[model samples]
Target: MNHEFSVAEVMTTQGGTMCQYTEMTDAARKRVRAMHNWRRSQLALGNVQNGRNNYNCSQAANMYKMKYDCDLEKSALDYAKQCTLTPSVAYNQGENVHVGPLENDKTKAIATVGEKCTHWSTVIRSSEKKGYPGKTVNSTFFQAVKAWWGQIFRNGVNQRMIFLQNLRDKPNAPIAWSQMAWALSTRIGCAVVNCQSNTFTVCRYRQE
Candidate 1:
């Protein structure tokens, strides 16, 4: 006698395979929990925390029994094997990328969720030209400069005088030049101005 099955029949037979594998995985989890409980019990009985120490041989015997009965090592090996045999479609079903925001600012981190940026420099340059006020960069730079020097000084003695002097020779400086000056000053750790005519002087926290 010869036996053959149609494609639909074969698919129907294989449909239950996933349920079976799921049951096996559940069984492995149960075994892991049981072994963990047994280990906890042994540790509770004044046994040393070391796994290899043989000071309490009876507890060791219990551990060995649990290990063998649950076949924890073998179960782990089987689970790994199942992972390797997972269908590509199933494996890729829920694949997604997650990006996190910058540390201090919730609104300003450049987070690429799925694809890596290939031309980050161009992106940054465009943003700068477009006057994108990145919150994270602005906040961190502001805090660093504020901690090192007091407030941003716009008067004659401040570094802005020198920057404006240099810009005076160049073509029309952008309206954002002052903003750029502030950013540059923050970067170079110079945000304080000294007053020579006053007895009481304001000082900033020096954060060298």
Candidate 2:
């Protein structure tokens, strides 16, 4: 389902090339989608390391590859352009937001978002007792990854099992992570909005 957008263009200023995006191009969408699925695949294959003890992580038996949703992108773009540095409370969607130094290059901006996954990818011990201690991560991509992948290992439960518990533990649990790894969630959309001094990279996932 493609939503049409007027041609997105780049403009050159004294500082550098600036992305005056009307919407992300198909290439941008594909890049973001591939980055996410690759991470998910790594986890599902037990290739990810458990930051605690270099332990081999458990594989997800039913992790689904993700698709890009134009609708999700539109919704994410609308909110990202606001540059509020906050999550979208009105839409109640699965979201990850990252604020970084202002980057005018769209490609670099998107790559920076991908880089945040490095922080999101590894799972480690925290101070929490419930096994998965939630930290304050500025509502960024790192936080989402922690919430999604950390708890499964932390609690010594299968990913699918924790997801069921997450459904009942909403508003308290870090739902963003679960949403990212949700077995039934097959779609995602993302946008990178460059404000004057910062860039807001937001990705929204379909909830199942």
Candidate 3:
């Protein structure tokens, strides 16, 4: 039997495959939640407290104003909101599934979805970019995320902290569309998200 994948199963010149979008949102939410979880931690530790924390406390209650939600801290709650509220399924579908967004929609989508799409291949080459001392390109999802994390997260965030923070119990940011394509090409697969001008960056999270 000669079984063949449909248009949605394979990536094309147009954009990301259906599976890629699914992976995109999934990876994105986890990552953001993880960020919030750690940010909350930093607040508790008084690391980012600016002038607070004369005394050292390792937990949130002792450090924060005690703003609690069903036992979770404001940061954790906020993390939940971000994950729940953010768009999960990519907007377009079917033959137009791989279609990229229009130039104008780039900013709007960024605001609404908190994530924008782009090509995964470009970002993969980043291993060769400056600040990335890795001798070779084409890194793994973890490595790619590590390299781009600094660029995406700056406010005094360092490479060491990125790895250290995820150790806590929170979901990491979601895998982006572009990253999704390369990260699991042989698996669920990927394709162009839309045919409109590639105005968006694949799976880029908005800063602040």
Clashes of each: 0, 1, 34
Lowest-scoring 10 consecutive residues by lDDT in candidate 2? Answer: 116-125
Ranking by lDDT: 2, 3, 1
Question: On a 0 to 1 TM-score scale, where does candidate 1 land against the true structure?
Answer: 0.17
Pitting candidate 1 against candidate 2, the one with the higher TM-score is 2
Question: Where does candidate 3 stray beyond 4 Å?
Answer: 1-23, 49-208
Give the higher-lDDT candidate: 1 or 3. Answer: 3
lDDT digits (tens) for residues 1-208 of candidate 3:
1111111111112322322232123232343334434444554454442213243222234322211121111122222222122333332210001112233333333333322222122112111122221212111122333433332222222222232333222233222321221111211211112211321112222211
**How many backbone overlaps does candidate 2 show?**
1
TM-score of each: 0.17, 0.57, 0.21
- What is the Cα-based lDDT of residue 172 in candidate 1? 33
**lDDT of candidate 2 over 1-208, digit per residue (tens):** 1122211221211221113334455555655577679778887888765434446557788788988877777777777666665435535456666544322233233333333011111111111112111121112233334445564444333333454554435443434445565566677877655444444556777644
Off by more than 4 A, model 1: 1-25, 48-79, 82-208
What is the Cα-based lDDT of residue 4 in candidate 1?
Answer: 17
What are the candidates' C-alpha RMSDs? 31.2, 12.0, 17.2
Model 3 quality (TM-score): 0.21
Comparing candidate 1 with candidate 2, which one achieves the higher lDDT?
Answer: 2
Residue 50, candidate 2: alpha-carbon lDDT: 44
1-208 per-residue lDDT for model 1 (tens digits): 0111111111012222222332122332333224334433543353422223333312222221222122322232232222122321211011111111123222322331111100000001001111221222222223222221221122122221334454434443321222222211111111111111100001111101
